[model samples]
Each structure stands twice: as C-alpha cells, then as structure tokens.
Target: MSNLVLFTELRQRLDDHLDLVSRVAAEGDAESALSMIRREVPGLVAAVHALVDEHLPDDNGSCRKCRSGPFWRRIPAPCRMLIQVHLAVGAAKATTRDRTRWSPSRHRLQESSVD
Candidate 1:
C-alpha cells in the first residue's frame, strides 16, 4: 500500500487501540490494556519499515554494508517527520514502564537517606 494510505490506516488503528486501552484501564485491567498496546507495536514497526524501504534512495541498495547509516537521510522529509513523531510516541509509551521500574530504586534511595 502507498505510504499515505498506510499512514492513515495506522493512525486509525492507533486511535482505536488507545480508546480500548483507556477503557480497559478504567475497568481495572492493566494487563489487558498493556497487551493491547503492545500488540499494535509490531504492526506500526512493519508499516514504518515498509515506508522506509519504499522511499529509500536508489543508492541505498549498493550500501548494504552500512545498512543503517545513509538510508534514513534518503527518506523524504514528510516521511522522516512522521517517523520522528512515531518514535516520540513510542518513547512516551515507554515512560510509564520506565517509571514503574524506577519506583523501587527511588524508594530504596529514600529509605537509605532517611537512615
């Protein structure tokens, strides 16, 4: 599928998943909500990969050795911008998990300081 069409579909899917996640969270089902969000990640990654492959410059094929280096610069500006936005969204999603993992360490530090 074309990038525009794929992007639109992905956006809709993401919205729907977000709504479901919110509902599940409200219902006190954190595991289900997290599962729903995680399930959508692979599809998003695949769509982005397809977009990159479709937009890569012709010279990209010859640079197989340094596969990751130059290919991103070849993607069109709009697609690159979309990718950046997606990455930011992913990082935002990960923040909750990061915070959860850090909470124990933070509590331990607080306890040690109190003594």
Candidate 2:
C-alpha cells in the first residue's frame, strides 16, 4: 500500500483505539484501558517509522527536507496529531525512571512545580 493510504488507515485505527480507551474509562476499567494503550503503542511507533523512512530524506548532516514547505502538510491532521502525541509521550516516559511517576498525585505535583 502507498504511504498515504497506510497513514490514513493507521490514523483511523488510532482513532478507534482512542474511542475504545474513552469507553473503557467511562466504564471504570482502568486496567483494560491501560492494556489497550500499551498494545497500540508498538503499532503506532511502527507506522510512524514507516512513514518517516518512506517520505523523509536522509541528508549528509542536515535535515533540509523537514524544514521545507508543504511536504508534511500533505499528511492528514489526525495522523500528524497522533505522531506528535506519540513523540510527546515517549519523551515524557524517557525523562523518568519509573513509569508509575505519571500517577495523578505526581502529575499534580509536577503541575504545581511549574507554576
């Protein structure tokens, strides 16, 4: 399949997974929601990797293509948002040693510290 088509399908799947997560949360099934999110992460990362490898250019030292206009703009918004969110989450995870540091109480502490 073409990269665009694959990206569109992956975005749809990610949307569906997000809906499932919402439903699970509403049903008070935190464990199941977390499990579903964990399962989806690898697929999301793989999709992002595939798209990057396909469309992005490998320069000698600089990323000139990424800074250029309209290439990334051709991608759908949902796919872009998913990629951004995945990167943000990955960065957040990397900054902390314990994943459990993302708990509600810790979040509140972090928020307060920012202010």
Candidate 3:
C-alpha cells in the first residue's frame, strides 16, 4: 500500500482505540478500560513501527523519490512541518501511562510537547 494510505489507516485505528477508551471511561469502568488499553498497546506500537518502516527510506531516512527526483528538490514545507509535529506527538505518547486517566486533552498535550 502507499505510504499515505497506510499512515491514514494507522491513524484512524489509533483514533478508534482512543474513542473506545473515552466511551469506557465515561462509563466509569476504569479497570476494564485500562485492561483494554493495555491489550491494545502492542498493536499500537507495531503500527508505529510499520509507519516508520514504510515511510523512512532504508539507507538515509529520506524519501527515495524526493532525494533523487526533480520534485522541486523539496517536499512542501507545510508537509514537512506536519510530519515533524506528528512524530513529536508520537514520541511523547511513547511513555506508558495509566489509561484510567488518559484524557484526549492529555494526549494532545503530549503530542504538542514534541514541538
């Protein structure tokens, strides 16, 4: 699959997981919610690895085409910025946390700190 498509799917899956956690938390079943989140952790980590494997070129971590092709000799600045933001967010979320208190605002703050 194309890198963009794969990334989108992975992101969507993450969102779905977060949404489920939110719903379960609202129900006040913190223990069960935490259990489910722990169960999903491995899959989320794998998905992140998959994204890196697909997006980063094997040799130098640059896009193969953009590195060699005449695609303006650059990727658009906005896109590069977005990728940086996404990666920063990912890094922030790497620290394991108690899912019982995993609020979306907290998730976003974690992501933003990478900036």
Candidate 4:
C-alpha cells in the first residue's frame, strides 16, 4: 500500500481507539474504567511527550523538525506545532470538564443532528 494509505489507516485506528476509550470512560463499570485508564493513560502521555520532544527547540532555539523540504528554514522554538498542541490540550481539558457545554451560533458550530 502507499504511504498515504498507510498513514490514513493509522489515523483511523488511532481515532477508533480513542473513541473506544471515550466510550469506556463514559459507560464502562468503575472497575473496567480504572483498568483501562491504568493500561492506556501512560502510553498516551508518552506518545504526546514524544511528539512534543520532536518539536522542542535546539541549541539556537529553533524548531529543527519543522525546517525541511522545499521550505528549508529554521522556525523559532514554540513553533506552530507546539502552539497547536498547547491550544488543543487546553481545549480538550475544558471539553472533558464539561462535555455537554457547547455553543452553536456563538461557537460557529453547525447544529447537531441529535439536537
């Protein structure tokens, strides 16, 4: 298979795994939820750390990973990737705290079919 296909499949699998984890978090028994969390949370944290580590600034405070290919240039530390991770993690934390909290028109979200 092509690299793009492989990458897409990998993305789908990760999404499915996360979805399963979400379901377990919301609907599983206490014992099952605890067991799943114990088994999964560390691995997920490690993976996130690995991604962050790749984007960390080098000695000159430049993002080495992001500077490559046609646009070969050393972007500054706390590059777009790091910024995105920060915003996404923050939003995710807020989402977890209140899953039902959603503003449609104000947030510019389309009305959900369920709503």
Candidate 5:
C-alpha cells in the first residue's frame, strides 16, 4: 500500500483501539485496563521517541524533517512537532491538575497526554 493509505489505516486502527480502551475503562474491569496499558504503553513510548528522534535538529540547528518555502527554508530547533508535543503535554498537565470528573473527559485527557 501507499504510505498515505498505510498511514490512514494505521491511524484508524489506533483510533479504534483507543475507543475499545475507553469502553473497557468505563464498562469493563480495572484489571483489563491495567493489562492493556502494560501491554501497549512501552511500544507507544518507543514510537513517540522515534518521531522525536526523526524531528530533532541537525548540527546546524535546523529541523531534519520539516522545511518550507521555495528554497526549503530551515525550521529552527524545537520545530512544530516538538512544540505541539510541548503544548499537548502542558495541556495534559493542566487538565489533570484541574480535573474532577473522569466519566466525561477520559478520552480528551488521554489524547492530550499522548498527542
């Protein structure tokens, strides 16, 4: 399959998995949620690390993967990808600190934390 197709399929599959986990967390046992976390979290962390590594600045302090403009203008260090990560993490932290309800915002919290 083309990369676009593969990426779409993978994103859909992950979305479906998240949906399943949400259902499990809401209706199933805690043990099942904990088990799923144990099984999938390490791989998820590794994937995030791989993306971070790919986007990291080169020796000249330009993003390795992201560029724009006719001359391919360099995006400086801490490119959009890393900045989004920072924003997501900040949102997640703020959300967690302010959260009192779990039933309504489960997926939002998870998405922010893992974005």
Candidate 6:
C-alpha cells in the first residue's frame, strides 16, 4: 500500500479510538478513557512521525522558511539549514525511542510524579 493510504488508515484508527474514548468518558469512565489514550498515544505519535518522514524529503539544503535578520540584513541559509537538520534528526530519534519503549504493560509501572 502507498504511504498516503497507510497514513490515512492510521489516522482513521486513531480518530475511531478517540471517539470511543469520548463515549466512555461521557458515560463517566474518564479514568478508563484516559488509560486507553495513554496506551494508544505512542502508536499515534509513531504513525504521525512516519507519515511526515515519508512525505517530506531530507535536507534539500535550502531553508524554505529562511528569513532575513533585522540587524544583520541577511538570510542565514547555512544556520537555518543546520537547525532544521538537527531538529529533523532529533525528532526522528525521539519518535523511534518512544515507539520502542511503548507497551501495554509499561503503563502499569507509571507513577503520578507531579502530585
């Protein structure tokens, strides 16, 4: 299947899951809905990351968003390209790590650190 088809399928599945969770929440099972979301969120993120990486080309060496500086009056193409590349790589690595770490059983070991 094409990447667009795969991405659409994943997006539909996530939307369906969220709809179910919303229904559950409306029935006064908010915590259970939250748990379901927490379980699926990693997969959703991975799907999004995959879609973006598939559609976008890597390092065309041109900053499409390159802007001129007010003080310097110059568009820093090199710096912008470097920053974009760094962010892209970092995002890919983080998404991969998150996908690897996600599991249904992993949720049981989570603690409420904020409280």
Task: Give the per-residue lDDT of model 5 (tens digit) for 45-88.
Answer: 79789989999887878888895564357899889888777655
TM-score of 2: 0.34
lDDT by residue (54-112, candidate 3, tens digit) is 45443544554335555456453333434654755655455434222223434443222
Candidate 3 residues lying further than 4 Å off, grouped into runs, are 1-17, 22-28, 58-61, 65-115
Task: Please report the candidate that would top lDDT against the real structure.
Answer: 4
Q: Per-residue lDDT of 1-115 in model 4, one digit per residue for the tens?
A: 9999999999999999998996897689999999999999999899989999899787877787886644446688889878777766654455333443334234422333442
lDDT of each: 0.53, 0.54, 0.57, 0.74, 0.70, 0.53
Give each model's clash number.
Answer: 0, 0, 0, 0, 0, 0
Model 6 lDDT tens row, 9-114: 9999978887776466446476886887687668867965665454332254333345335535544345444544455445435433244322234322223333
What lDDT tens digits, residue by residue, belong to model 2 across residues 1-115?
9999999999999789766764674465678868866776678679767766544433432233344455554443333434554555654454333322233323321322321
In candidate 1, which residue pairs clash?
none
- lDDT of model 6 at position 107: 27
Which rank order by TM-score, best down to worst? 4, 5, 3, 1, 2, 6
Question: Higher-TM-score candidate among 1 and 3?
Answer: 3
* Clashes by residue pair, model 5: none
Runs of candidate 5 exceeding 4 Å displacement: 1-6, 22-28, 68-72, 93-115
Give candidate 5's total backbone clashes: 0
